[model samples]
Target: MKPDEIVVGVDAAWRRSGALDWGLHEARLRRRPLRAVHVVDESLRSDDFAPIRLDGQVVRPSPIPRNDRRLVDELEEYLAGADPALDLAADLMIGAPGHRLAERSASAGLTVVGRRGIGGFARLLIGSTSESAAVHGDGPVVVVPNGWQPAKHASAPIVVGVDDHDQNDAALEFAFEMAAVHHVPLWLVHAWEVPAPYTWNAPVANGMREQWEQAARQWLDTVAEQWHQKHPDVDLRHELRQSHPVVALLDAADATGTQLIVVGGRRHRLPGLMIGSVARGVLHHATVPIAVVHEHRATEPNPGQ
Candidate 1:
């Protein structure tokens, strides 16, 4: 894989989302080959503002409209002026946003999309294209939240969510690699809540609750120890929280000034459902940049099922 090749999906609402700048900044920093895909809806390519139908499907012209060519030219010039090492290219593809991005992402080192669109109420709803990319992209999808400004120094730490599972190592490794590249620390966070295991004879008994919580802590400690041994030189620290994973991660981000949050993606097996919950939580709510490591395949049943 060419680590220098990064792809970003840009839509008509890109200027409003302001994700273009954030994406370009990262690509320039890494001196990677940048690909910007603008998927035009067929309905948008109309002289009379009428949708165009082709092959039983609407077709929108690719690469943005001629009116927007100036912006693209400006971006190209800025990239060349800011970094001579950066090679930039733009593609205007006509297709479904989600499908086009997913298909192209297989060969990209990274893919970036904005969280929301342009408008008052629409800004509150995450963009459907971005949501699809997050859940389906072959490579890591960077969710640039609305109003996110690229840091000048990029010194903030990388935070990763971990649970007792085999794929947790992938998330940890990704987090450390990011930290190493940015010269920042890594915060290994594990949030645990005692399972509300109950019996038909009675409600959940608190008598054994403490025991279960203790066991959970022990599991976190064991995982943390293993990771620490492997990454001895990495500036790493650990946190074990007795709260919901989603809320705990938010609180940790606030307390630690985190710039990126990482989590594991498990597709199949017994533990699948167990880790799926945490991944979903972060995907939906984590405010900072999220790096979801897609590891598990869907064929396996979730653990404890």
Candidate 2:
């Protein structure tokens, strides 16, 4: 199944169904055809065209019995049953699951993987696969956590964390798009760094905190000006904090009852091996869905400097 667009990344785990719904939602949002990919271990070395079922909570069962039960067939049947409006296709690939899916994400508008995958990627647990997508994938990566049901979170706002240390435009773009699509509000949160004063002057040290707090506001205002102008209808709100970015981000998401948290990684000098601390930190701690957008410009210096 080689159709040209794949916006959702999925595996064969039980969570695959949730991943499917996630992809469908994304397709509906972008108004494009949807593609679901299943990447098995290269050792299996076979393009799987076997039958499967989509109605059941699990994948390997006879819930929807039929002779021509290919993986994509089950998905197509499910999509058709679910909604005839979506244009969908699917395929199979044999490779290292995490890296292969991340590689596939290069051409996608966004790559979404489940909290847990199956096959080679699932062995090390979902963290490795989802983190690999967030850290190295070319486009933005959305990690749907366990028990992620859209019905429950449809009304929640989208939260984005920004700082001067890394690029924030990509995050803002994603957040605004999500807000616009769901007709929800967007929360723009900025958490500044608190470097300790080098000297023993307590008075001067106390002044530094105030200066940094002021800087955080300026950073939020600058980014907000550009983003809010483009999305005039979005209910945009901002927060400035002197606490750790990760803690602030998680807390803000919780306080605002947000369903998704969007963050950005700084451009790595080596390109494939590194990611920013804030993005990595929130990935492990946030209870809601997480989307990590990579820095768009390699030459753009960290604005925090």
Candidate 3:
């Protein structure tokens, strides 16, 4: 049986080579096919058509261009240069990139995109496409930093932010899988802080902090033990920190030279909503690749079920 394809968003304006490389790496590790997608927003095109240059000749866009030949050529060239043996496909789609990629994620095992795209301003740290995919994609979405080459940090461990919510199960599972694939260690980090109301009272705050720390440690221990039993080959380690989730994750990632950081993406009923604050913050600030896995997808039955 064919494995689920790994979909990656490709853009000519942004530094997308890194994203493609990361997608290829995952595809090889999971023994899956890689689909490189480039979406053209017709609404942004002048006169409902965008001109293209192919083979040193200007080609006028048709009423409905199914696919860009230039893009397909570029994708094929990249694959040939990167890995000739991998099963790779190129798709040129028309619509909003984020929405299109999210739709593709419905059947995809994983979706990968660059942290920032050309649509947003220079000051924007995270692009709309990356954020939308992470928030709305069906499964795990990995946002790779621009110009980030996976080979540079191949020896680093996979760091995952663990919490009390059930959503963290997906993140932990992905982290462990990645660690196993890369033959590296896995670090599970849980960060906690006393509530603001309790912090107002000094004595109460002290006691509450201690309790919270103990609870966090116990929870981390339980999670670690369970995952260790499941993945005996992974060198799994756990840590509890008294800091903000974003801060703790970033610090742990930096300290460990992490290759990838995994976090849980909370599902929202409403549209146009951002992902969880911690995931958003880390996506904006971290220089490393970040994978946001949705809990609903985690609970879903596997294919052919």
Candidate 4:
């Protein structure tokens, strides 16, 4: 497990070719190793099974084996087909899929997972495992949408959500690096809105909205300048929207034909509060690949902050 390796979750029950392809593309772009991890839940494998009543008849199911090499072999075959010359490794383990992936992400350069899996509901856009890895992982986790092919969007820009605070510095850094790697433009988006209380008064709401937009624009300008200085070769463009964060990000992606959307993910100590609302919303709604980076990983100070 190299620290700079890109870890991609390969689910045995789902079609993860998109994720594998995305991971391979990223690895080649960044010149990093690719690791495909397949985890089988330990709890799901039982040595003993109780008899169950099926159609008024007693039926006993066979015990599931704990160690399964078929998934690992399948993953290796997929990786070989994607790129035989690429640096790739495969890991087969027994544990909760999401939990193991999140743990692996603590030292990985990036973690990639499919938006949905076989266990996910048809209507659900994101699966529990992918959501868990994105929210609970220490580093950046990218959730690749179904049927996504990097070759189709080879020249698409990378979109990143910017906020007033420096919480999104890591996300910005990741987005800028991706943009530089792909030699495409980077769009910095900051969305603002007036408070609901002020909205009750039309005059106050209008004034507050104006003030917020001005402040947002100023902040975005400063951020864009700093990032430009750090990454002079990459093109930087910014936009300020008076709408929800998710909506603004999606709109920016749609308008720019963004291949990847980057946003900050916060890890909370409490359960159910692991992920921020904006990150969760974008994860569930965005059609393109989305990267959720944690702020704590931003070891270096953001310039012009």
Model 3 earns a TM-score of 0.87
Better candidate by lDDT, 2 or 4: 4
For each candidate, give its TM-score against the true structure: 0.79, 0.80, 0.87, 0.88
Q: How close is candidate 4 to the true structure, as a TM-score?
A: 0.88
- How well is each residue in 101-167 modelled by candidate 1, as lDDT tens digits? 7667767777787777542354454667776666666646677777677674388898988876556
Q: What local distance difference test score does each model get? A: 0.70, 0.72, 0.82, 0.83
In angstroms, the error of model 4 at 76 is 2.0
Rate residue 24 of model 4 by lDDT.
Answer: 87
Clashes of each: 11, 2, 0, 0
Please, what are the lDDT tens digits per residue for candidate 4 over residues 1-305? 78899999977653644787888888888778899988777667666578899999997665445335777877777777766677887887667889999888888888999988768688888888898888888778999987799989989999999887547777888998999899999999999878778877988777677677788889888988988998889888989888988899999999999999999887454666766888889988999999998754445355568
Rank list by lDDT:
4, 3, 2, 1
Error of 2 at 22 (Å): 1.8
Better of 1 and 2 by TM-score: 2
- lDDT (tens digit, per residue) of candidate 2 on 1-305: 23235456665453433666776776776676777776655544344445577676434322322222365566555667655676776656556667888777777677787766553343443566677777777657888875678767888999998877666777788889889988899999988766755346767767786777787788789888888989999999888876788999999988999979999864566755457878888887777788888654443576678
Superior candidate under lDDT, 2 versus 3: 3
Which portions of model 4 miss their true places by more than 4 Å? Answer: 13-17, 48-67, 296-305
- Candidate 1 Cα outliers beyond 4 Å, as residue runs: 1-3, 13-18, 43-71, 123-125, 199-205, 266-275, 296-305
RMSD in angstroms, all models? 5.1, 8.3, 6.1, 6.6
How well is each residue in 13-130 modelled by candidate 3, as lDDT tens digits? 5344468889987887777888888887766765545778999998766454434557667777777776667788787787778899888887887889998876779888788888
